[model samples]
Target: MKMKTRGNFQLQRVIGYFHGTIILFSIIIGAGIFLAPKGVLKYSSLNVGVSLSIWAACAVVSMVAALSHAELGTTFPRSGAQYYFLKRSLGPLISFSYIWVNLFASPAGTAARSLLLAGYIIHPFYPGCSVPEMPKKCLALAIVWCLGILNARGVKEVTWFQTLSTVVKMAVLCFISLTGIVLLVRGRKENLARFEKAFDAEVPDASQIAEAFLQGLYAYSGWGVLVRIAGELKNPGENIPKCVITALTLVALIYLLVNISYLAVLTPKEIMSSDAVAVTWMDKVIPSMQWAISIGVSSSIFSSLNCTVFSSSRVLYVASQEGQLPLILSTLNVHSCPVVAVLQMTILASFIIIPSDLILLVNYVGFIDWLQLGLMMTGLLKLRFQEPDLPRPYKNLWQLILVLLAGRLLRDTFLHYATVSLYVDPLKKILSNICIRNACVSRQFI
Candidate 1:
């Protein structure tokens, strides 16, 4: 009874307007926001104003990139985000790299997130001692399969969890932000008063600022979530721009306020030293609610992990749909889920999750992610020029901002890895992303 395309089962447009917004919001508002401020502040020499400015700047850049992708999404409205754009705009060779890279990038990124979630959830049980890697990784793998099974079960189920998690994360963050704002109003400005001299200190060097920028961008990592699920939207052309504007505006506002909220109670030193910023903030203000927020953070990450699996499997599914991979991978079940694609992702994530180092995974995926963004921006330019009359319901010059952001990312990638030994980490991550089997990817792609 379902529609067929090119002998393949077709996907339905079950994702209505609000559900699409939740998908984007939940994915974008992942653990990065709760954890990234430390890296941003430390890298920026603990400059409060500079760190806050970086958060704002990152939001603007993410907005620009999101708007540009919204245009592209309106045009293509397909499964693959960067890959489809590359194949259409640039050519096959470059676009092919996207699939291979995502095969590794998606799982690696997912593993890191899962590990972070597990660490948070399990660490509290140990009280003062550290959690062993085995428990953390076992828990992380369990989460991957659990969420992957949900994904395998149905899109509707995945979206339900996604929506629930989004609401919880939003409510939790809003509560924290309001609590901090209220405290500041009552003249309890221990760390809040530091804002008056926020910009008083000397500026961090370009490299530091660049590092902080990378951290900020990580917080805004899921800005391109809409394009990955563009086809599922009720009316992509209208909904994508709407989702981008609505979801991203809320994410950016929440991120800034939450960072301020953290600062309101905890000092810059405590925040930088903290393994959990929100928990630390809660400890000072309302000690009893700390446990609840811990669970909330885990819930947020769990949903985020599911969303990552949901979006990433689509790329794998699209790969199969296009015949780049076996046809079975694209096959859907009774629930219209790409069960094969979801399972393969879970298997791969399980294997590599053993070596899950959050920072390493972040750096690895960050470079490749931004690199793809660069190519997507390049492709956007080509599409604009070659098909001037393309039916684009939404249009913007945000492509240029994407291009600049990509350039800045590349600059920092090189600057941060000046030494050969240090540089090899990025190289390893790239290799890890593109190389899975005995076959090795070409070096030129880097």
Candidate 2:
């Protein structure tokens, strides 16, 4: 592991492979599955078969990308996943670009998830009307502060919450899957008929298919969590790959099965009309237990927001160690948590709530994620060619990963550009500052 960064503060390696798997699994399987199945199915043109196929294909692509990241994690065995990888292989400028962009983007993501949790909590109050933004923002900031405080408490407490949240998420999903299974066991094969002619419907066009793939991929976007916190894991060289592979595979299977259950139990109209598909599914199947699924969904989003705060702080801490940022972020509190780093992230997220356009902020900033991943892919290949004898414990499987990501980048670029078309006026104003901000962000201290 590279500790060349000047810091006496060290993170304890308390996360064993099993707990590591739990944490990664919880992060990757966020509120997306509960809410996204409908959008994925809708975007796939309501073809049950095509929708399932898209889910499966997205899982495969995610697995490949994650394994490639595992290879990088094992090779580098460092805390700041993309930051460290790019700095070592691609050069500091590219690495700094990653950290700099993330400085803005990561908070948007954190804020978005916390706001989503707020929306979930508040929706019941105002049934049909749009949930007011001011209250959501207030609740969202509160949740961010609470989760950040939890993170500052200790890593053990944080991971323990992750375990509890993951268990709740899995239990809710399993309940949904089990209901479908029970129907099949009772000779109720009617819902299973949805997949009879999978691709028979009007298939989505190239652009639409690309958009649907984006939705599916978004649900699987957090597969690289193990690599992000590699330094804190026990035996990172051996365990990083194991945890990434295992967690992604399990989440993929769970997602597939959960989607299958949805198709089986709900009518096409029911699936399409309801935004919260799980809640609707539970309403019809077991009306009495609706609150349980709701709580589970809340936990799902909460855990994800918790993880964003927990992990993104590490980037600040690592950069501090590397002397790219103030030394305050490098120090740990009595709980062995990166208190300043966590609070920095938490406060940033709090401020981002001022924008009523977080969804747009998240969409706009998501380009950086693709850019970083593409860098890691290319950089790792470059590293291999440059240092052929470099000790690589986990082998990569990403020739296809690059091609797939390149296609996603181009496709997302087009779709994202089209999305920005609606906000061309505002986007133009925001675009003006991007170049200057990107260059100057790397030099900012404190």
Candidate 3:
């Protein structure tokens, strides 16, 4: 195998601490917050308290994973992110698989979320109308291209947009949370009182609760995007851990309050039945806020799509730089951006948007996403022992806790799907498809 030569590409380190924090925040607080509360409520059997607890638990798990990344990121501080970490600790084979799966899975995830954004944008205009696949795909295409071009221009430009979008998204979520509190203070007894019966009913099976936890984790999925582009940041060793920790804490708090706000306006049953939780809350509070909320949600998803493009392209560039991918993808244009990698990601995402249901898209990527996460975290642990002298700005204090959490997550995932032959059958199909895709990409390098 060819070894990476540092002389091939020069990366600019222009991103500062505050901008780095905003990038992480923008990616974590995407459309999931607007749409995922219902699944948490449904899976937790309509219990407001339990649902909130699950959200908190998932946040803790996410935090542990972020802590692990902080240590690995600060020590290595490279663009390949997980791939770099895995390569150093495990071997090239594992690193190769990480890039191969990510090549398709990352962009497919972006397409899925963009499709979700399109649905919300169109829903308010055509309330009950069924949007055909083509229009949604077209809208998804537009978003991918717009963001792809924006990212190709420069890293500083992307950081400014991310900062502004993060501010707007946080303000909207905080407004909703504060509005819920105000309604409760004004003697909105019904919404607040539901907490009284949070545990009054029979609980769901363990399998169902596990599934709900998985959904909550999906909402917290983008916590690690910052480290992927660590090479572009100023003072990366200090900034990386700072950004990861601050962003994870802020996102978890925002998510918790948002879910609380939803429950405050709509009953658990109402929340479960509603299609869009945030919009529904706004409609209940002030019907005129519908358009405003839709804009906020769309803006939220747009920022996430932009960040996804930015980080994924960087990963591609890093892979190519390391000689794991074709060198053509490592080429940069005059703007100091990976032009070819950006184009490659945009094309893959467009293909993903063309034919897939939102729910299936979400589930299809969940197992692989978590599995990769587990392997990466495991690699981090091994490196701690393997490289005792390696400098680390942040220590992964919760390594043991993360291991137990991942164990439970994987164990429950298997148990839940084992009983359902339907879910089990699809696992094989998805793996086969991933292998086929991986093979096709590998042949290009050969």
Model 1 C-alpha lDDT per residue in residues 1-446, reported as the tens digit of each score: 24234455677888877998888888888889877888888888888899899999999988887888777778888876556778778886676677777877888888888888888888667754667889988998888889877887788888888878887887888899898788778875475587878887668988778777777888888767778877777888898889888988999999998988887787779887776778777878887777778888898888888888888878788877776667778877777777788888899889878875566567667777788888888888888899999888888887876788788778867655545424566755565444643223342432
Ranking by TM-score: 1, 3, 2
True-structure RMSD, every candidate? 3.1, 3.6, 3.4
- Per-residue lDDT for 39-138 in model 3, tens only? 6777888877789899999899888788776776788777766778888899987888888888888888898888888876776775545556667778
Q: Model 2 Cα displacement at 188 (Å)?
A: 5.2
TM-score of 1: 0.92
- In candidate 3, where is summed lDDT lowest over 10 consecutive residues? 1-10
TM-score, every prediction = 0.92, 0.89, 0.92
Stretches off by above 4 angstroms in model 2 are 1-7, 126-130, 184-190, 354-366, 418-446
Between the candidate structures 2 and 3, which one is better when assessed by lDDT?
Answer: 3
User: In candidate 3, which residue ranges exceed 4 Å CA deviation?
Assistant: 1-9, 128-133, 415-431, 434-446
**What is model 1's C-alpha RMSD?**
3.1
**Which regions of candidate 1 are displaced past 4 Å?**
1-8, 418-446
Candidate 1 displacement at residue 238 in angstroms? 0.4
**Could you tell which candidate, 2 or 3, scores higher by TM-score?**
3
Higher-ranked by lDDT: 1 or 2: 1
lDDT, candidate 3, at 219: 87
